[model samples]
Target chain A: MSILLNKDSRIIVQGFTGSAGSFHAGKCIEYGSQIVGGVTPGRGGTTHLDRPVFNTVEEAVKKTAANVSLIFVPAPAAADSVMEAGKAGISLIICITEGIPVLDMAKAKQFLKTHAPQARLIGPNCPGVITPDECKAGIMPGYIHKKGPIGLVSRSGTLTYEAVHQLSQKGLGQSTVVGIGGDPIPGSSFVDILDLFERDPQTEAIVMIGEIGGSAEEDAAAFYKARMKKPLFIFIAGKSAPPGRRMGHAGAIVEGSAGTHASKIEALKSAGATVIENLSEIGSTVARNFKPVVA
Target chain B: MKLLEYEGKEIFRSLKVPLPEFGGVIDKPAQINSILKRLKKGPWVLKAQVLAGGRGKAGGVKLAKTPAEARAFAKAMIGMKMATHQTHGQTLKVEQVLVEQGVKIEKEFYFSVAIDRKIGSPVVIASSQGGVEIETLAAEHPEQIIKKPLDPVFGLLPFAARALAFELGVPAGHIASFSQVATTLVKLFIDKDMSLLEVNPLVLTPKGFVALDAKIVTDDNALFRHTDFSKRVDIEASPAEREAKKHDISYVGLDGNIGCMVNGAGLAMGTMDTIALAGGSPANFLDVGGAANQERVERAFKIILKDPKVKTILVNIFGGIVRCDMIAEGILAVLKKMKLQVPLVVRLEGTNSEKGREILDRSGTRLITASSLWEAAQKSVAATGGKI
Candidate 1:
């Protein structure tokens, strides 16, 4: 089975009446996703994109048996919306809003752990995920994706699209692709998705796209070196960008902890991951690594 | 946004955190006498209020034993062009000076509250040995440093604060005030939406623990609620970068010969990497975001061309949510709006990218088009005569 999403998953839209919510939800439905209902606080008993709208996610889940939530709530209340979905027992919450306050996310993450232990959150500023052909739960362009054995995870949206399009060009299809968001704190880490990708029998190889930000890539490398049995390929962005170098930067500098591009790349490479030298060559590199593929 | 020393101290002052007696702030040397008149001291510290760090080693900070000395130091500092290791070779002009009463320091310790991404929470970082070279201290004597992770939601609790003060060996009589300092730091950190709140060399004087230096960096994304500090642009960036911020584009200036613009942040960074690998130094990192329409692309081009070092421009766009033909039209419109001296290499991909490429090819401009980022990087670098 494809990880996290499939044709059987029933999805509901939060902030369903908003322009972004309505537009993307409509696109998801057009792509053959099972959009059963929606949740907008005041506009219950209405119909959006031919789906019934409920006032609360709890009510929508109870009535439609919706297990997933696609949230397009604005930044100020985006974290609250995620928590609301988590508390309502929605197993998977995908937030597409950007510009959320870091502390607000920290609190929302804490709430998710303490109150809604069963729920999983994906992004606050990401492109979302697609299981290709079967389902599209995010704002990603759906037509370019094809179902295959390659599983992908990234911190960026368009860059994720680039990898997928390149792979699709080389006749490589993906089992599942996820954008875990590029914020300082994300709802899920690279390891979180890697765990799922490794266990999915359909996913034979994994492509991880990371950038110079948090230590998530390093953490993932640790997990891979110890536990992963599948082949892993990786790319870390921002290698050419300047880093914040200052003696005063030690203000926040923990003793030996760093998230520099060199450190992330070196870590993953040492962990036996094939580091692509050029971003545009990711598809070709994976193609060469995976032999006898039919185009 | 990074807050200057005086700005950070103002927050500390408002929060009632322990601080040395404030003499006053002055921009001119003549104004120093008035501030010196109010403070009770023989020697005062004249700190140049420049955004650049490493002030002590750069002569931006000086001690004045007399009123005349203070004025002289202020005169020398006020309008001084400061270049530090942190400024990326750019000079930061000192426009203000802060005067504070000198205190007898019995000991110095490092204390800070910052978002520790590794631990996934805010943490209390302290060290018995602290100074300008704290990083050096960390490398040599790691055990001297004490780091405690705080509750991400509630912040540092009282018992945690008490334990920290005791562990740091605060005097039993002053442990309560030390705990108060810890509490106020977390309070200000969360309330102000600060990414980092650092009080390096938290001095222990006969009076009490005073934050001798305060450096605060607030989360730029959290500025919607912090409208008082509503400036989302980085104050420390170059002039062109500040201009890009105003136009809602992500731009960072670098010292290279080839300038590049792309659609997304990660892709923009990757473009720079490709440029570097292709034997060209990328002059800047610029992302026009998903909606790279006519006006926005035009603004981005103007910003990129401002740097005198940028000899050639590379435009890499991967149409995701936005269509390729629309961006192609935008680039064409930009060419019409402005005259270009630098050679241009454009690469378009994703949705309807072939149509977009065809539009550019037929536009009759001397623009080179590439099918991929690798080819675009090579062409742009070659256009620079492979000199870089």
Candidate 2:
């Protein structure tokens, strides 16, 4: 079974009337995810894509029993959508919108801590998650995936896709792939996803793709070293990146000796992780390190 | 985006944080008279308005005893290129000089309010050891520095700021003002969506604690909320990089020869790493964004070609959900129109990628196609006369 999503997940899209929301929600529906209903503020009585629409998240939740909320709101109003979803008791919220003010996100996270502690938020600036063959909740390509054993988590969107393409080529599929996002303060952490992956019965091994930012990777290493028995193959981006240069839109910056690529690699290696130094070898290294899982 | 010292001080002044009296910002040597009229001073500090740190030790800052001295300093600094350790090796060109009245300091202390990534909140840091050597001080004596993590929702407490002020060894007379500066700065950090707000050598003069210098980096993601600073330019970017920004492309210039045009940021960084692994250096980091069409393709090529060091261009586009044939046709269409100068190596992956590969093969335009990253990187490196 996948950790956060599966066949039973009833998903609803926020900002459903908008182009981004409708497009991705349609893609998810195309991949067989249950697009139960949606919420788009002013257009309450109207219906789009053969789904009922509600003005508020509470009414949508009550009407459709949507357990998973996928947010595609714009940056300025995105955090409000997150808080509203949490307030409506959406257990799993996957936000696909990027560039929400960090302070807004941080405050929303704090609100969720007391308001709906049970809600697990995936990202506010990330490509969502997908449990291949069963459900595709995010914007990830549905074709490259096949039902298998690897549980993947990453901070990047297309980089996760790149890793999946490599794994798929090797005839190794995944249990669930979670994109935790690349924001300075994301909704979920590596440790949280790692905990879920460790407990999931379907996940045999895990692959984590971290980059030059934050202490998330190192924190994961420190927390999961001795406890995790499954083979963990990891790859970090930005080894060739210069210090003080931000590599991307998200929090991919190498600062001093703290969040450098080399330091992250060293930390993960010391924690008994099989670190893939070469980008092209992520799949091959995983194949060599673990007992093969047929696709 | 990083703010220059003068710009940061402008914010600090607006927030009512005590700062050294601003003489003037001089674009030319003749503008020193503006400082003399406003400051009415004999001694002034002439500082190059640059984003680099360690400017004091790098000769970017100097003390001017007279108007003639300030004019001379301004003349020498206005168009000067100066480098510090923070600049990584390249020099930053000084376009303006900030001439401020020099104040006598009883003591110096470091104060800053910045986002703490690990805690996922704002943190206030202070140290009695200040000045340009604060980095060295932190490296040598970590205990001298004190930190207080704050919740951005509730903001920093006055008592907490007082404690930080006290611990940083501010005298009793200046504690009130110091705490005021600390609180205001924290509020400014939250309100302005700043990533970092540093007041180096927040000096204690005879009257009170005065901010001798200021540095700020506003969050680019939150720039939409603040329209004034939205048009941010990376002071360290090369000409090609600045042009790429105007074209809405993410490109960072590097000291390499193989120009890399990749699909994603993470993949772009990874591509650069792989290129380095293949015994080839990447000329720049270019993420052509998710949807790469004819216009973006032409724009990306133009930016990459602007870099004279680029010997080969490696285009790695990973198609997700969107079919690659359309993107491939767009790339081919763009490629056909351009008077190409360098070897172009392309790798297209994802749905309908095989058809896209066929299109590239049939086009007969000079191109090298690879199915994998390794093959593409190696081919690109070989095109640049590198052996792997």
Candidate 3:
């Protein structure tokens, strides 16, 4: 009943022969994700994790009819791998590679618009999406997620896990969690995933985690103001972060009076979302908004 | 990485773009004589080589009508700390001054090629109003600027360049030179994997369109492709920053007493926010990243310890892609090798967290453990004598 992914969704692992790909794919499989096959150039005929492997994404898709492609390719070639997955007609592509050059991603985005407009690219430097207890397509720990009505979307990896852990501790399970990535230009945006959560019947409320950088949060706030149907809570990081210096993430920076924590919080507050000042208050804040749920 | 004005001009010259005649860099007043011998004539421009913008307003850029004036300017600029609005008042030491041939008065225009993330392609922006902030120009008179998006595949077409030149109101005689300069700038941007290439005040002298000033920023991720250019990185980064760069970790120093070690940038920042909320200021921001092996974790610990202001350390690991036990092992290894004077608080969650906790417990190090982020922040702040 979750959005984007469920127990029935078939998956294909890109760069499946690599250590990271094989390891995380095994974890996803253990969590009961329907991993149909894998793709690794030149190692096509081989079998990995008891599934068939193909030289190209097209071959993998043609043989196994895989709907989702999870990428673990290196940073330099990640953009091309995304393009390959899109060209092969995969409906959902999740890239887990980081440190990709911004220019390369720009070209890939252009290529996707013209070549594979239907394909929805999630992240090239993000922790992929997870529909708890149904399917897992990312590097997040599968044990902590619980199946429920709250849909979580964030721009960070571990921070999302922190929120999920808190929600679980509060007996508030989640329907789906998507990490939109922390790059200056991600393939998907907060509004894109919010639109999904808004339409999904299973998701009742949403938790959004954002950090300093870009105007994505402001854009999402504007969207929520106009078309929000559910209670959305937010927690932004990097309030005390120094300006002009990048705060870990490539996109987590305060540029010339823009992308400040105050500005982001003010934008979301004015847009009718409850912005939590502390990370520890997210669980209680969401709990207070909705009726008490029986654990 | 931001390149100095002189280094950016080197790339422009390498791409065959027209620029003011080369004048050597003068780091010392004595070097000014050698630079004058290499340059064309009496009148020259001495620009302080600093990374921040608005150097002209800061008096970093000066005109020297005589060699004695050039020597005086170089002496005053070198070893001086120059501040700019971009640097946020943090002064950058001026190590050298660029000496170039002065040009006659004609006209000034702004030209730059940069990645427009919204459009997912390289965008070339040109304005007849030059030597002013582009942001101000865009806000005040947007119609005065000509914005063109270049095709990533086919690149900047000849017709597109001609169109931009005509739209910028370039004289009919200088159209060819303007087009050449524009094309060359684009080529340099693409060839060197540059994120931004700006030629502010693209001067229109009697000769043609010569770049009066240049500023270039190359992509750090694409540095592997350009080994030579990677070696030219001279940002005067902090020592901790330099060490973190060597180990591929992200670290930013702060003026607090609590050092934070966390996995993932988003979580690292969240940890910092939580620490502040718990009534303690973080000494630095260190993200061990998603794959925190023992070596990287050890290096992160060393970098954090190098900051003498750190009074306590907080280690928060969610262990998603990175295993918690691996981080625990790194911590144990660092504790065994070095004398740690600061109190330590560790929080491990998800993916073999029990095993990681067991390792930390068995190590017998004088450290506090927490099962949640809230508890971790409270414990670290309390350990540092900050009320929670």
lDDT of 2 by residue, B1-388 (tens): 8898998888888878888778888888888877787787668999999987889888899998987887788888889999998888888889988988899999988988877877777888888888846567778999998888888787788998888877877888888988888888889899999888888888888988899998898888888888878866667667887787777688998899999888778889989998999889999999887666678878998899888899999988788855689878987887778878888889999878999999999988888999999999999999889432
Question: Which pairs of residues clash in candidate 1, taking residues 3 or more apart in a chain or in different chains?
Answer: none
Q: Which stretches of candidate 1 lie over 4 Å from their true place?
A: A245-257, A292-295, B231-234, B386-388
DockQ score for candidate 3: 0.70
- lDDT of all predictions, in order shown? 0.85, 0.87, 0.88
Interface RMSD, all candidates in order, equals: 4.2, 1.2, 1.5
Q: What pairs collide in candidate 3?
A: none
Q: State how far residue B10 of model 3 sits from its true place (Å).
A: 0.4
Top candidate when judged by DockQ against the true structure: 2
Residue-by-residue lDDT tens digits, candidate 1, B116-157: 766556788997676655566677888899999877777888
Runs of candidate 2 exceeding 4 Å displacement: A292-295, B66-68, B132-134, B231-234, B386-388
The TM-score measured for candidate 2 stands at 0.96
DockQ of 1: 0.49
Q: List the residue pairs that clash in candidate 2.
A: none
Q: Write the per-residue lDDT of candidate 3 for residues B191-277, one digit (tens) a residue.
A: 778888998999899999999999888888889788977786447578789889889889999888999999989888998999998
TM-score of the A chain in candidate 3: the value is 0.98
lDDT of 2 by residue, A63-96 (tens): 9998999998999899999999999999999998
